[model samples]
Target: MNIVAVTSCPTGIAHTYMAAEALEQAARDAGHALSVETQGAAGAEPLDPAVIAAADAVIFAADVEVRDRERFAGKPTVTAPVKRAIQDAAGLVAEAVRAAEERSDTAPAPSGETAPLDTAPAPATKVTEGAGLGARLRQWLMTGVSYMIPFVAAGGILIALAFMLGGAEVAAKVNGGTFQGRTYEEITDLSALVEQAGYAGVLFKIGAIAFSMLVPILSGFIAYAMADRPGIAPGVVGGLLADAIGAGFLGGLVTGLAAGALVMAISRVKVPRALAGIMPVVVIPLVSCLVIGALVIIVIGQPIASAQQAMTDWLDGLKGANALLLGALLGLMMAFDMGGPVNKVAYTFGLAGLAAGNLTVMAAVMAAGMTPPIALALATVLRPKLFTPAERKAGEAAWLLGASFITEGAIPFAAADPLRVIPSLMAGSAVTGALSMQFAATSRAPHGGIWVIGLIGKPGLYVVALLAGIAVSAACVIAAKHVGRAVPAAASGAAAAEAPAPSERAATVA
Candidate 1:
């Protein structure tokens, strides 16, 4: 039998290539012709078109979704966990050949005929498009947000380091920052300011430069999501217009959507064959950006600037009940889905506030985000009988994950029993958020959890708030599980985090 295969693993490290090699050796020993594609960190060379067209059957050994899976649609396919190929390659290969016989009996394309692309069934790995416009809009915006975060994290941390080293008064010595009304000399020139503020000035200026790119990066990526690479130039130009008019991040959001829509519309129009070659490079970018600039400057700029100012003012004045309510809301959002869309919304709100120099919101959001995992870890230890051995093992790693502010570390437990776990997490997070706000805790850095404690205002009180929330969440988990028949966690929940990264995804395996 002629066969084709694809192999992939989550990290795309050793396992992907290992599986491919195992399958290839098995096929050679069985005296069958086989070609394998390994989608790994090393790289993937797609199977030749002729090879795919001639294949009698296919096998997919993947721990993650296969890219462009429609290529194998209607073929007799055997799918299994990636490790299965490494462990039982001969058995899996036999299954594929047997499955091909059944496939021929059912949907007999002529012996040499290949299925047409349009007629192929949808791939199993596809996320449904039936989710509607609202979901797609959120996804596009999130693409931008995902790209924007690195800029914020880097800039915010550097600024915190500047303040830490320069005694929190370095801004007063910079070029025309809000003067703190003290008897001190300040300089406007970059060269002079560096000399006056020393290394603190250097760090602050570098951070400020990075911060300046935040709006443009967000806008560009949003447009990219909507219209692919053709949308980037116009989106960036729109962001520049937004910054020029003091419209801030809100203006950038508006400009990004507009740029993307415009590009999409332009792309659909027919153009002369000679000109079509340059349309993306010359026509679309030039035309779309001009429209985006006009829309920002003549239409939407001032209203967004006013709105941005109002939001900044409101955040600056947040205290008492108002602060507590906002904090609790943010907390609920963070714990709602752990690292899903709802969690991202709350994080984005905090980032917006951080950019506007409202540090308190950032503090509350981070505190709430850290609560769920620690709470789960504590619950596993304090009440081991309520959890399976696998969950208890996940709990051990959750300690470092939680301290590092990786809320997704708690996802394994949440997925097992969301009914009991989610509410407990939300309740604890709300408490932490409220307390952090009430204590006027502030974070100069966007992330780092307890490691960045020195950059947080009222760090002592912040720790107290974290501890309080952890206690509440853990107790709730233990109580909730004890009162109910504990559901056995899916063995697959163990895939939650073999490696930790600040911005990595928590994608589900099929």
Candidate 2:
């Protein structure tokens, strides 16, 4: 069999490439030829047309909409979430083969028109709605986080740069008297702040504008993920209202989900042929926005705002051991499964706190998250013989990935030896989180590892906490390896030997 597949996820980081590698290996193991296209945030590497034409079946393992899906029109198709491909690639391929055989024998539709891109076998709606309630909620939240991250990175880094270039008061200086009491748009005299703060003033303004869009973008894209194009406008509007009403990130999440579900329900309404044309463009947006906007403003706004304020106050009130304990808990969660659902839950919690103006939680979470990869990298450097040559090389790459705060860098190591690796990672992560909290460290940006150190409230302490975790984790892994070699070498060596080489593991998981 010849197979063509496309893999994607909302974040376009881990799952996309993991699924591709899994499919390729599974195909090879099954004595079939497979070509995979990865559509990710880094961009798409599309499959050749010749490969597509020769393919017996197509598989779409995605969490986001596939681009240029028309290319697969009329192909026997199997669609599943990207995680399924990673976990059971062989099964998916087998299913696709059967689907292809059935397709080959079946008669075509009488009209002879190819099914619409979205109407392919296993439509996205079925894929999402078929999942258990918990899975569906996680998927929705992750969709929002994935879309919100780019804005956070850009805005956070820019703001950090502004502070680095100027003094700590750069924002105040830029906004205080620069425009002579005029608004940013209405300010005609750019010369005033330019003369006072130089380029820093300009950078601050730009970053502030970007920061302002964070909530709206999160809400809009969440809706887009849920209801496709029709959900965008209302979602954004709802987010804006959330912000205006001081409902914070939690409220933005609610608005995004509510707007998406409302629009999806509205889209299913029966309508005349004349009205159908305008439903998405006109009726959907108009009705969804009005309904969502009214509900948010009249019923939801004040209560959510009060809750946000109370949460912020509680976070602010945290001191000493209370903060450290919270940080430790968050850290354990982060390293428990690397980029899995447990890790995402911790990250989402941090993001929620950040939206409420509590940067300490984000600081602790990121520090903990970065520790596993860095620690593993350090371990390989300290004790190379314990790891395969391929793993040693992956460790070198892990340094960069860890420095960038891409926690998925550690996934390969964890997958190879979950029992030893995961526990060691969690220990180090907990230490890092506790120390960071103890020091009262804070970070303005949600992403970016060491590169955004300037944005951290206590840069020196943050680095110290990170280093402490790395050392602890590295030591733990080394000790685990040594102990395993002594106690379970005979029993575990065969399974370890059967595990794929480090390069293969990296390709599949990284």
lDDT of 1: 0.69
* Tens-digit lDDT string for candidate 2 (204-294): 6776676566667767756765776678899999988876775545567778889989987887677998998888778999999999899
lDDT of 1 by residue, 46-69 (tens): 999889889888788776657666
Deviating ranges (above 4 Å) for candidate 1: 1-150, 175-188, 242-254, 273-278, 297-299, 306-433, 437-459, 466-510
Backbone clash total for model 2 is 0
Task: Write down the worst ten-residue block by lDDT for model 1.
Answer: 117-126
Clashing residue pairs, backbone N/CA/C < 3 A, model 1:
none
Where does candidate 2 have its weakest 10-residue lDDT segment?
A: 488-497
Q: Per the 3 Å backbone cut-off, how many clashing residue pairs does candidate 1 have?
A: 0
